[model samples]
Target: VASKSNLSLVGGNFTLQDATLSASSGQINLVSVASKGEIIPERGELGVQTPNISNFTKLGHIEMINSRAETTGSPSGGISIRGDQFWMDNSSIHADNLGDTDGKYIDIQTNESIQIQGKYFGVISNSFGKGDAGHIFINTPYLKIDQGTIDTSTKGEGNGGNIDIKATKIDVIEGGIIASDSYSTGNGGDINITATESLSVTDKRIFLTPEQADFTSTIGSASLDKGNGGRTTINTGQLIMDGAAISSNSHVSGDAGEILINADSIDMINGGTMTATVMSQSSGQGGSVTLNVKEKIYITGFRPGLSFTTTDVFENLQSAIVLITFGTGNAGNVNLLAKELVVDNNASIATATTGLGDAGNLTIEVDNLYVNNGGFISNSSGGIIGGKIFPGFGPAGTLKITANNEIVVSGQGAFSASGLLTNTLVSAPGGNIEIQTNKLTLADGGTISADSLGTGDAGTLDIKANTINLTDGGNITTSSAYAAGGNIAVTTSGLLFLRDGQITTSVGTGVGKGGDITIDNPIFIVMDGGKIKAQADAGHGGNINVKSNQFISSPDSLISASSKLGIDGQVRIDSPDMDMAGFLVILPGGFVEASMQNCNTRDGSSFKVSPRQRTVPFENKN
Candidate 1:
């Protein structure tokens, strides 16, 4: 059906299948009423149609399958649907502007629920000319989309329109998408989602086929050309993602947008990812990702047997939350705030740059944090460029973590240990790592390190905690290949314990000096067969300074600052309350003999107690 004017449809139960409805610069209204009500129509100043129902009652169901409703032109018309429940299968609602005028909006409101099911169908608002695209608004109690999409884009000089969704519960699964993009100079539209209860995005494919290798459930915005990507904001009670992706990315010279999420709890499992990235060959700056969760944030790596095959090669990717730049533009930052955070099973939270630009920082603040089984938190820079190694090519990003309660890192993964690290491989300066917590524990080969594998100085590592413990090969280290090693500083208020662990800084090659080690203001320090060394290959060794109230070490424990071909560094220990000789008391190895005389007259009438139960010869004499 084609109309040059307004189109209105009202019924108790409305269904449109395999049909098309077109309106040219006119309004289209579909209202389904379940109860008795009188509909009143009114016209606004611009001859816009508005329907006001007196004694408004309950709404009825509206279904559309393989159908389309669209308006295309300069200053295109709007589409509005009001019903109790709305279902669309293989259908689309589109508002397109082909002229120099701005397009109109698309509004959908349902009292019960809204479900969109299809493989590739969508509700789209687009701009193909110089005009801006239209906005989309959806309001419902529950919203579910299975493989369908709700999106906005701008291919012209004008900006894209925003999308706003408000629902109690939302589920987007099986390659479903909610996105906005800009393919030209215009900026992409923003997306805002607010769910009162929960929000989920998931995919079911465990083994990706060749055709579906790049496909997953997604919610994000992209800039493919000269336009900047759009921001994405999500607010919900609970957020869950499995084998899904949430990103704001750029492929060209446009900067990627930021992502913000607020939830009570968040879970990312089975290769789920949250990223802001600048792809290769792009000069656009990557965007940032911020997650503020009240309860906890849990992330697990890809499940076993989950792999993608390409050209006889199988690749497995871990679950991650990252900000990366592979272009000349700098990468963005990743910030997380939660009560508790757990990254396990090869999962990672990182910020990195593999291009000429610098990497961004990674910051986390939580009550408790656990990184186990090859989980990692890092910020790094430098990678292969033009088929050659670029060591420290750009400045690596820093990492800072603050935990109110405790921070624990333990276990190892396939190639790395669970740890916090900062690395650089180019000629630029490396990044630093700082952590502050009430208690810090590293065990089972866990590590905290800063390394420089190029001709650049290594970064520093600083830690402040109430108590520090390392056991079972847990280590804190800094190293450099051809530059000065990074320094390590640790301050603990309560105690420091190390068992079969190490704290070291070393330079492998060149005349670069080893880094220094400092431990200050600990009540007690104990090292049981632990090692603290700062060694250099060709340069001077680093100094070690330690100040504690009490210090104890095993015979096998080692603390050395040595250089093979250069001057050895100094090691100073200041402990005022440690005196092994003064605090120890020795006992004699002799027996005591006592002679006892008893009053016979008083003992005969009284009760006697025998302490040793021994018989005397005086009894035979009596």
Candidate 2:
């Protein structure tokens, strides 16, 4: 059916198979109704109004198979579809502006569900001339897209259109995609998705084909030219991503877009990635990723408690949530707020720059945080990729973590330890690390470190906690290969205990001076087989300043500040006055009869012995 003016299709159980509906410069409306009342048409027109829609008792289904509905003109026409259940199989709906005018929009409203199943196109709104593309709005109870796509793009001088979806539940699997792209000088469009119940995106695929085995379900936007990438936002009750991705990346001079997610709980496993990155060879600034989760956020490399049909699917995959720049522009920051955040199974949350740009900061605020099984959080600038030096030019970003309760970092991963790190391989200085928690525990090779490998100075590490515990080779350290070493400062209100742990700063193969270590106001400092050192190779050693009430160390523990060729550093310990009541023993309050023997004619004498009101310091044996 082709129309020069407006067209309307209103009935029950409407089905269009191997058909075409085209409007040259007008609108096409499809309304499915199941009722006995009449649907009053517009005066001298063929379409019904909004008030007549309520006369229907119920809505019917709409099925479009191998069909196409499009409008092509300078100012293209619009398309509206309203029904109970809507299904599109090997079908597409398009609105394109062929000239220098803005395109019209496509609206879909379903009372029941909306399903798009195909290996090809689903819905598209594009601009081919100098005009802007139109927006796409979808409202349904449940939405499922398999091996399909919904896109809005601009290949001309105008901007792309936005996409808004509201549903109770959403599932995008088997290489399904929702995207906006800019191929010209205009900016890309934004995408906003709201799911009241749940949202899941699964699989990774190499291509979008019916015979393609892998699934790469993606929701992303990209800038292929001078325009900037579009923003992506998601709001859901629960979010699950398995081998899927959500990304906004730049491929040219345009900047990447931001990503915002709000959920009650989020789970990302099996190479699932959430990233905002400036692509290689591009010159744009990377965007940021912000997550606000009410309950928890869990990220892991491999799927737990699940059997995979193809083990190679996740053989070399690693799940990550990152913001990185591999271009000439600066990277963006990552901010997360949640009740609990867990990173496990070789997963990572990081920000890095492998090019000329500077890396961005990473900030996490949670009630409880756990990084175990080789999971790590880091920010670095310049690195050796593929065994070749990148020599990135700028400084690395800072890392800040604040936990309201406790933080536990334990266990090692396949290649790296479970910890937090900041490093720089270029001439720029490394970033700093700051952590604040009520209680902190680092065990089983867990570490917190900052280092520099080039001429730049290493960054500092500052920690403030109520109590700190480090055992089983856990460490807090800093080092510099050719520059001045970084410092470590720890402040605790309670005891600072270390068993087989270490706190050190050193300079290796460099003429730079070593860094300092400071421990302040601990009730007691106890170290069993632990070491605290500030050493240098050719420069002066660093200093160690400690202030505690009582300091105790095992026979094997050592604290030293020594230089190999230059002058040694100083070690200062200041012990304040403390109450001695807890360590003193008082005399008894009763009197006792005592007997004494004198060498005077073998006679025995007896007397009354009274106790004194005095106390004596007790000695520790162990």
Measured over all alpha carbons after superposition, the RMSD of each candidate to the real structure, in angstroms, is 6.8, 8.9
TM-score of each: 0.91, 0.87
lDDT for each of the candidates? 0.87, 0.85
Write model 2 residue lDDT over 367-465, tens digit each, in one string: 999999999999888864334676667789999999999999999898878999999897988999999999999999999999998888999999999
Q: Candidate 2: which stretches are off by over 4 Å?
A: 1-4, 38-52, 204-215, 303-315, 384-390, 576-622
Against the true structure, candidate 2 has what lDDT? 0.85
Model 1 TM-score (2 dp): 0.91
In candidate 1, how many Å is residue 26 off?
2.1
TM-score of 2: 0.87
**Clashes (candidate 2):** 6
